[model samples]
Target chain A: MKQDPDKSRMNFPNRALKWLVILMVVFLVIEIPLLISHARHAYFKIDGWFAFYAILGFLACPALTFLARGLGVLVRRDESTFGNEDDKTLPEDLDEQLR
Target chain B: MNNFADFPPALILLLGALLVPFLKPSWRSVYVILLPLATLFYVLQLKTGTGSQFNLFTFTEEPLEFLRVDKLSKAFGIIFSLNAVAAFIYAFYYKKSTQHVAALFYIGGAIGTVFAGDLLTMYVFWESMAVSSTFVILARNTEQAKGAAFRYIMIHLVGGLLLLAGVILTIARQDGSIAFNGFDFETANHAGTWLILIGILVNCGAPPLSSWLPDSYPAASVTGGLILSAYTTKTAVYTLLRGYPGWEPLIWIGCAMAVYGVIYALMESDIRRILAYAIINQVGFMVCAAGVGTHDAISGATAAAFCHILYKSLLWMTTGVVLYRLGKSNLCDLGGLHRTMPVTTVFFIIGCLSMALPGTCGFTSKNIIIHAIEHEHLFWPWLLLEISAVGIFLAVAIRLPYFLFFGKDKGLTPQDAPSAMLGGMALLGFFCLFFGFAPGTLYDLLPHEIDYHPYSIAKVTIVLQWILATGITFIFLKKWLTPKPGISLDFDWFYRKGAVQFYRAADTTLNGANALAKRTFIDGFVKWTCNFFESGASRSTAWLMTPIWMLQGHNAEEIDSLQQSIFKRSKRGAFQIGITAFCAVILLGLLSIIFLLE
Candidate 1:
């Protein structure tokens, strides 16, 4: 059986995602060893920790994202939140005021 | 003209700004670009030493130094003029001459501040920079632009005042020596330096007071925003390095701002707003370096400022081109543009050199600062800087490009940037790669002779690790990191809502007191005095007749009748002659007694 072209096109995102994940894995496989050896001469002792930045980056993204989401829940506002506030300088009856 | 070499490079741009509108549109555009290039040549000609003096009718005990071309000033002047050219080139196609004039005046002020030798001279140009930058924002002419410009100038005026206050106080204590130098030892603890430090910090957009930058800058015209970014904060960094190096509070303030910027940027959805927040993040590193205050750290700071202005301009211009073409810059509204706008996408990718990715200008410039932090073993600050690094990289390099350029197609097809825009972007892109590849060229311009190298294997890989982690996490957790279509509150809420609240409080207090004063003084006491003057004659006449009536043995009713008759006559303005005479005699007698006593 042959696949429909439009359906395959729809699957492009999935396939691209799979390939991106694979490429990142390849980079990681190489980076882990390079990072460990380089940590030997590092000034900060934390760099000596295994996969320090990778781990930091991995942990940081979700943490900051969720944190930002929490902050967004607290401070996030409609685009119009500042509209009325900014327009306070303009009189309600602008024509009358201008007159 | 024999001493034409003594001319400050800033004067060229300042004069050019006035003449810009007179030229034809085509010539005006050419003139703007040529002016900055001329500035570049003039700046490069400035040798390392004090230049000329400008005495203001014996204002100071000695002639004030106006043109100081040390390595620091020279480095800043060179980059500022270069970016000014690129900035003007980016705007070459726009027809409005006012924006060009504002930008020229703005760049002139920044360059002047960089070269100023004395505190007074620096302050004059510093404030001029603020005022002119406001015009740049105002050129947008939108209500939002107007509001932002108002807030921007208000905060900058405050910052300028603080700088002026500090300069005055420091001069007073130093017996009128107004030279710009580091406030250290006893001077470091003085209130004067603290004021100066805070003044500079406000311009650096440090936290709490930091929202003014993000609040106002995003509302500016696209090119205006680009010009706004390059000069104000970097010049503040210059003043900071010259005025309060090794000021320790900046370490905490800088680190806080770094994290604050990334967090806010992570939350922002507007493409320009995100970049505005990113400016604070980048300047945070420079501010930290200024705090470290070592010779190498100053070098690191100078290098970072140079590269920052260069790469940040590229970032702004590339996004600006997108904005110009599409009329939309919100992350939610834009996606999958790479298929259509490939060149801009590529330029944007190059501009991400600001993210400190491997082989980008950020890595070269940022490496010097991080290395300085580690050499000093400043652990907590170092850790915070790294964390900020992770967050900023994710926000800009990953989240920004992914959503705006390469995510789900929004079915919008826009042509790539105009060639003129591309030409401008290419100018900056070349510099980003130029400094990235040949970092030694940048290093040679540093103020100190630091024996440091940026391209060590260890140094390169660590930044690589950050990118690797930033990429992987962003890919997997892309859902959480997607920018929602909304704005987040910052400290500006205080000034925005809070400025209103402040106005309300002031109104209630001031006006309430005014109304109360009217009630007590005007209505109560004043009316009483007025009544007394009008009616006192009748009352006094009746009282004086009581004693005489008793002496004449008149009955109480008869006496009262007599008194009432006299009072009624007096109310009609016809007091009986005898009673009136008695009262006048008493008043005259009292006056004569008072005179005799005196």
Candidate 2:
């Protein structure tokens, strides 16, 4: 079963991801005409631009991700010093149980 | 004031909670539920005017407005009391009397702070909230919690001290007119006002102090965490709206908080702590709105705070349920709970949507703040708020739920949360959608009448686009965004590790000085005096006896030898009793002769 899951993981671009990409495309298409009306209520000139918020949103998460990752040097620390917080709660053979 | 009708509604919860420990569980549960329910009704029906005034200070003509009822205070009071009821339901089965009482005090303190007409009353309730909530953190009963609770109280105590100093200074300067209002520029620029702002900002989880919320809240008991997530920071937001509206510095501060919260929350691992950080992000919107300080902006801040409490508490309740069942809160340890805890899963999604997607209270309330920012033409803040909003969606609405519920199934199978928890979540979840669909219901509760309709097609579509775009990005970046089994460092480092270092340095420096003092005074000067006294008797006796022996023509060498022997013996405390007694007699006889002459 583990090998089967690993083999599946080796496969590129699963069905769920493919479906998500398709959904994004559809959403972008639907957002286009609405953008005209959205632009009318725009505060800045950029709001009238093509999918400004969508473009902003597209990069925003990744930007934040990279930014956080860069700052991870400052933020993250290894748990090894404390050694296995989950072990305190989990059964002793939890790894075996999983396998 | 004499009539029961005019009694402070907050006291209803505060005094009513005192009887909890004495009551049996069944009665206690019912009583806890009824107390908040009664307060909720009372606050909702209260007219917009100050009453329950008392002249605590004879020097000042103004009496403290104990029950200051207005649109802003009433709105907060209503939600606080309502959440109190829901929290009691959630805690009904917790069975810890201390947790229940602490939760009540926390809620009452929040409500009192909301309705306080003056800085003094507000500070009292503010401190009460601070202290009681510390107990809630202690309710977790883990060593990590004990440490976190200590740090939590330490930060809040500092904040409280700042607030107290500011209140006293401001009140004293104003001839003891203790009424709370937005600080004007002359007042705002001063040391006292700045201290007050810093104090309130500390509680708001602004920079350098932002880590306290996440550090502490996750360490609280499940229900206590929910109660905590609902109250502390939101009260500070309310106070900001009341006192520091239009302070231009707040705009920058709020934006910093907005982005800071998102980035840190995204980095967090413990699901409850993740939600805890998200609370700061949500409060950041309100804080920013308070900075915007227009009529609509204040409304936006107030509305955001109100909606935020419901949705955020619902989120906490859902996560609380997860934490309760699994005995863990980290995402690395939790997954596929959607299958077993379907109701909780659904509620969790509602909470996520309420935070990000359209047609939820998150959409409605957040839009109001964004709308205020847009109308005010604040470009940079608007940009940061937008990006932060998307980041929030990705982190909480998308990342958190996907991993905890829908991700790969773990081998572990924990049962669903108890019905009481589901009931609490459902209460808030219903409102999350209710207000989203009909924002007019919420808009009417704002401090000022707002013509803002949050469900514009443009707003809805933009939120939808961000959701889809962010959702796609999350899928692609899943591996990168997945948290490792570690905690992110934050400013709490100052007190956590730095305080230990501080204590060590202090210990070394202070004790080093103490040791030096001991050596210089006791050993060097005092010890010499001790030795002088110890040998003085024998030395004096030898001197006296030698003089007398010389008068009798005894040999000088013999007298000198006797003096040396006496000195040596006395140094070791080996002086003969006879010689000492003889010396005392001779000294007495000499003193008598001197006295007779006198």
Most accurate candidate by DockQ:
2
- Model 1 residue B532 CA deviation (Å) reads 6.7
Measured by lDDT, the strongest candidate is 1
Native contacts recovered, each model: 0.55, 0.55
Q: What class would a CAPRI assessor give candidate 1's docking?
A: acceptable
* Candidate 2: regions farther than 4 A off: A1-24, A35-39, A79-99, B1-5, B186-188, B536-598
Off by over 4 Å in 1: A1-28, A32-39, A85-99, B1-5, B185-188, B509-513, B516-598
Q: In candidate 1, what are the lDDT values of residues B187-214, reduced to their tens digit?
A: 4578777787778889999988899998
lDDT of 2 by residue, A7-76 (tens): 6777656867787688667776857658556444779888766667777878898999999888887769
Report lDDT (Cα) of residue B397, candidate 2.
90
| Steric clash pairs (candidate 2) | none
Q: What does the i-RMS of model 1 come to?
A: 6.7
Tell me the tens digit of each residue's lDDT in model 2 across B1-598.
2323477787988898899999998888888889999999999889987567877777655777778888999999988988888888877776657877888888899999998888888999999999999998887676767777988998999999999999988887777788788887555578888889999999999988788898888877778788899888989999999998888888888899989989988888889888988888888888899888998889888888888888888888888877777667888987888889898889989988888667888877778888889998999999999999999889999999988998878865766767877788888899999988898888888889988766667777777777877887887789878876888878877777687789999999999999999999988999989878988788788978887889888798988988888889878788689977998999999999999999
